[model samples]
Target: MKIDDVVKDTLGRWAEEATVPQGLADRALRRRRRSRVRAFAVMAGATATVVATALTVPALVQPSGGEAGVILAEGKPADDPAISLTGPPEVSADPDATPPTKLVATEKTAMYAYYTWDNEKISDTRQILKQTWYLYNPDSATYEKTPWAAVDVAAGGHVAVLEEAQARRVGLLGPEGQVRWIDLEQPASQLKWSPDGRKLLLVSYAANPNEQGVFDEDGSSREIVPVTRTGFSVVDVAAGQAFFRPLPAGGDAWGRSVDLHWSDDGTLIWDWDTGSESSPPPRRFYDLEGRPHAAPPDPADTGQEAGLSPTGRFSAIHSPDRSAIAAVRDTSSGAITPLKPVAGHWIEQAIAWSGDDHLITWACELKGSAGCEVSEFRNRLLLVSVDGRQAVPLTGFRQNSQKPGSWEPLFARR
Candidate 1:
């Protein structure tokens, strides 16, 4: 009789009539359980005045001109400095050289941009000089050079998205070394592969590039821009169909970074707001047809940007002490268990989950007495376990003191 009951009845009928996949149903049940817990927590503390005020106002925060103020929403220390370090070891061997260290996980391979002071130049830029692609072979304990310029690699090493030198086209490299080219109308800034490896999301830029300016003592300033694209494209690899969607002007003006990701089921796309300091930006979702969809309710305000594993079973979180420590959080129970801390180093970013038990993360050493600046600090790829075991070094030495720091390491299951 009630509206909520009517909606539940409609959903029940739909579930009974439709042939739903078991995996999808299982995931839905888990989400519903989590949502109910979150709802109960909200209802316990919510008041009429708070609810009325929230409905009447927009929750957007404007960014200041210079460096954004550190809000520390996750209980991290306000004075926490950026990690810094020395350059990596110079390449003395062949052109396709690998790191000196070896990884314990021999089943996975890593793809990264190898930087050296010497090499042929395709285009002379501040960052791209003498940069090439290399594949780390765990079995041989060596690095193999690949011809294609890989931007991102998919899971299982089945597909890769690449960009050719001055070609103005994007290529999708398949398993057999075959290439399928997708012509772009504008230059692309970022490429991300879906968790299922079936779709690739490409973000492109136009006139007003996404950049920030840093001023020197003399008042002269230089701009540091990463990705300048304002539009996005979702490519279906199997069907070879690419659809371009242009973002509304000023849609992403508030954030310092733009993050795009595919939903777990691969049926929707999420554009997360990384700029808000007070709370996690309410995520915006889009259906496969590019239509805007209502976002699902949150269970609780975790107050941290917790990185969820590919399976959504656990979250990679930082310890409250803000030391060089990492932990695993069980999503269902919200219990935090500390992973064995990598001595003298802190987790910078949790890149991906290698499997059920292992996580691939970037870590930097503890700050020196002189303090560590981000420009001088280097990060190394580490393979760590959930049970707090010793962390394994996967990549070469620390990132070389290049202009743009180090290349982000990409992991593929072998």
Candidate 2:
């Protein structure tokens, strides 16, 4: 019997297998057509490439530097007319200095930094907070204090912030600086905006220490307090309500860990603790409503790094070791297309999905053992395409060098 037939014969034993070939081919053709249209657009606009976008607002762009206030072809900005190019500019060059039409995040030394949804606005942790928000307006290249710090402007201009002196209360601010609602009971330390910019997910520890009589306002505790609580809560911005989702119960499970990611369409994709196995088999996904939504598995091997495409039609997952990237044919179809190797050790680095399924932002260490201890030395950024598997270095991340210009994220114009 032929290899195809032999594999087809035993495929039934698996929990899930590939869908029909014709369907996969059709989707691939559609993807190519979409890509061609985008390529034509990029060629038409030779000045820059867009990385993201929001409602009606021009996505942020990183203008190359040179000629001071001009975008260079190589993506680096030149020294101001007042200062010599020999060293970094010490002082601001006139508030009138044209903020680069884009905000490029190059090597930064600030102790804390906040990159917003549009990347147009940034908050240096050293300066801004709930009471004070330093707003960076790229259009005029100026900044001022706002009511809230680090607002998610990509969505409907709603701002999420932690209330001052209230350890557990998080308040949402409106455009005119009005309080919308507050989650007084729950204490979510970290807040994140959904990919589509519609909702905000607050990840917090489930247990409230104040309720258990562990520590008083004076930092006094009478007796030992044992408690059990750990998980996250999903808040609906439009309806003004929240639902708490508990973490799975089991031994050897990593509790309330980091790295919980949301796709463009707002689907939360994360790994379930299947013990400390070498690979951590059986990854799962949850929709906004908290429903099981795995998009069919590949017939050949187990999948890891399962991510949804920007359009949410197709999802891609990488091998555990980053050898290859396999994507499901579509939302409902289980068929898989294994793309060629795009990066080495993808799990150790950061992967960003651009406007569509065929492209992704590859950020990884350029060299070294890809170790936790040495990650700081390996910091580098790469731009790669899923289809071409071509890797290109973004010069803005050159080690110890100043960035070209402030290039903000401009969404791929759909």
Candidate 3:
């Protein structure tokens, strides 16, 4: 049987054999009632992606605990700058009288989640997350921000996917600030736009097995929620249609940490390995239909697979000495080209390519008074030319006590 057929069969068997305890069933019904009321209230004025009558699926499985953390892989290039010798340019010393209200609206700017403390507590879990954009200001020689909330943006900056976190709804934001909401059966967490900006990868989590009782009671223990890969949905923005396919099996039990990458052609979604070894994990690819495809031939075991360029010709590599420098390795020939390294800083990871000659990467300053340690640093977005000549800073170094550094950036070329 085909993979899709196998998936359908498995889901059918699960649906038939799954049983809910009486207490759990009662709780689920009550929760559903509450959700329905909230859904109706929220959808009254907004454009919903799905109709009220459409069947809703339960919470899909996420990596672990319904939260995914960013993973940075470390390795020297199996094969593998110069603009500033004094170190990265410092930001303006003078404090602004008031924080800027609007970001510099430009196609070259990239949007990211900027989290700030809403309270005096130092915990990030209590912080408020605002969508923010980073734009370079040539006059001031600094990067500025404009706070905007968006789940993902297309390559051209003409369209954006917005998520209503509270309502569990997805919406498309046009260049003119227009929105068309999409209603999903299950709550989704990660929203990744394809390289071409034509498709989106939406991931949802499974139901939490360890839900607490309505009233707190002594010895009231919740079940341990296993880490499982629920499934993914492919949304075609132009067509305004989303297709969800469940995994054939219960899903991988690899916990909640996963790095998802899209093939340059946008035909396959690659789930990279998160283990600590230098060897690449077994390759896995999922097609648009959510069916598994045969593993592609191993390109090279360069340990830079996660940072492959859009053309698949090169992979971003870091210096073995952790000097805050980066280079590119030709996948086939294993030839390495060292790019310009920012003074007093190191490149975190190669995010995306701007054409074939320039790469977007995260650069971090070495922190600590005694000496520089990779663990102690602050990061900002940068655009670096492959020839070790031009290094443009895109954002100010972001550091917080709660996080190792600012949230990772999502990049696209205009």
Candidate 4:
């Protein structure tokens, strides 16, 4: 069948779904999900000739492993130059309103690089999450819109995207107009840039990895399970090479956290190894070759997302006594510093360190409550000092909404 016909029929059945909400099925022109569904349909019927033709990248080359790894650019690849963040002053706060296109970032982090999710029902048991990416453009000092289904930005403003939602290949666009591409032997849906912006960790799956299908579609339960992840590939853009390895098979994948990220040191990549159905999956680590490896040790483990603030001075860990309040602890003395709460919000997790003392975090909504709701859905990106004295707003309040206005922010290190 034609790709368009296949996509339409699948979506047609989903629109008639009574179990899910209309927000997913509405399919307005602006919020159309054809790109998301087309991914799955193309994978099932796409031929080798069609894929080769669609690649279009003229400078296609093979990886050192004898597999396809295309590098498209003129002239010899040059060394990565130094990158710095400078522009308008770092703004302290903004009124809680629409999604901010203009964002202020620190030397180490950028708020303009983020993404929002869209859900599409494919079957009684399966659904797909489409990510709309907004990458930071240092040239304009503002966020530039990107409609690519999957993309990731690095600390140095380099971007890795799934050229298309099909996930067969990965595309690289550097800050200096340097273009590169990689053809993973398998289909991959997720792309994460390494800390140094030198490599990409591409997670491959039997089907599109974003497929968070209903845990039990025949029943009324709404729990979601990730699609089967087969393996991953690590592509070194400068070297113009990629290495693929399959994930160890075993364990119950139901409701497992499938997102894989780079180790703090960037030497290893990590994910969970679901062993038993009754117990939680242990955090498993792997080397670049996808071999079983040890986890990255937290020398001064603060139990906070931002492990240690730059100078190893402060961290935002949970309050020793009050679980609702987050404590700014001095790693040296292990003393809990008092955190001042905002008018109707309290900082929860620390995303990245803005400076030696300040952190980019989420300040959740408190809605007239005496104590802050720890996991309250309503929150926004905020910059708070480790001393808890200064509280600044980066982006306005966002929540788990169908509208991109309230979606999770994917911050990239700058």
Q: In model 3, state the lDDT of residue 283.
A: 47
Error of 1 at 115 (Å): 7.6
* TM-score of each predicted structure versus truth: 0.57, 0.41, 0.55, 0.72
Off by over 4 Å in 3: 1-150, 162-168, 207-227, 248-254, 258-261, 272-280, 298-306, 310-313, 320-325, 331-333, 339-341, 366-375, 400-405
Rank all candidate structures by their TM-score, best first, as comma-separated numbers.
4, 1, 3, 2
**Greater-lDDT candidate between 2 and 3:** 3
Steric clash pairs (candidate 1): 38-299, 84-377, 85-377, 204-229, 205-229, 340-388
Q: What is candidate 4's lDDT per residue for 273-371, written digit by digit as tens?
A: 555343334567888887888776763345555656767787766556543445678777878875546656666556567767677776776534334
Off by over 4 Å in 1: 1-132, 136-150, 164-168, 184-187, 207-220, 223-230, 249-259, 273-280, 296-306, 322-324, 340-349, 364-379, 399-405
In lDDT terms, which candidate is top?
Answer: 4
Cα error of candidate 3 at position 117, Å: 8.6
Q: Which sequence of candidate numbers ranks them by lDDT, best first?
A: 4, 1, 3, 2
- The segments of candidate 2 whose C-alpha lies over 4 angstroms from its true place after superposition are 1-159, 163-167, 173-181, 194-198, 206-228, 243-255, 258-271, 274-278, 281-306, 312-350, 357-360, 363-377, 389-395, 398-414
Lowest summed lDDT across 10 adjacent residues in model 1 is found at 37-46
lDDT of 3 at 206: 66
lDDT of 2 by residue, 1-414 (tens): 999988887786563565232123323433222212111110000000110111111112221211112222233321111101122412112211222122222121100112221112122211111222233333323333233322332322234544322224334432222233434335554455565545666544434221222234476542332322344567665544566576433322232223243533556544443444644344456665556677344421212222455465655553223333333345567655544334442222223344344433323343333321223222233444545355544323323212323222222211
Top model number, TM-score: 4
Instruction: State model 3's lDDT.
Output: 0.42
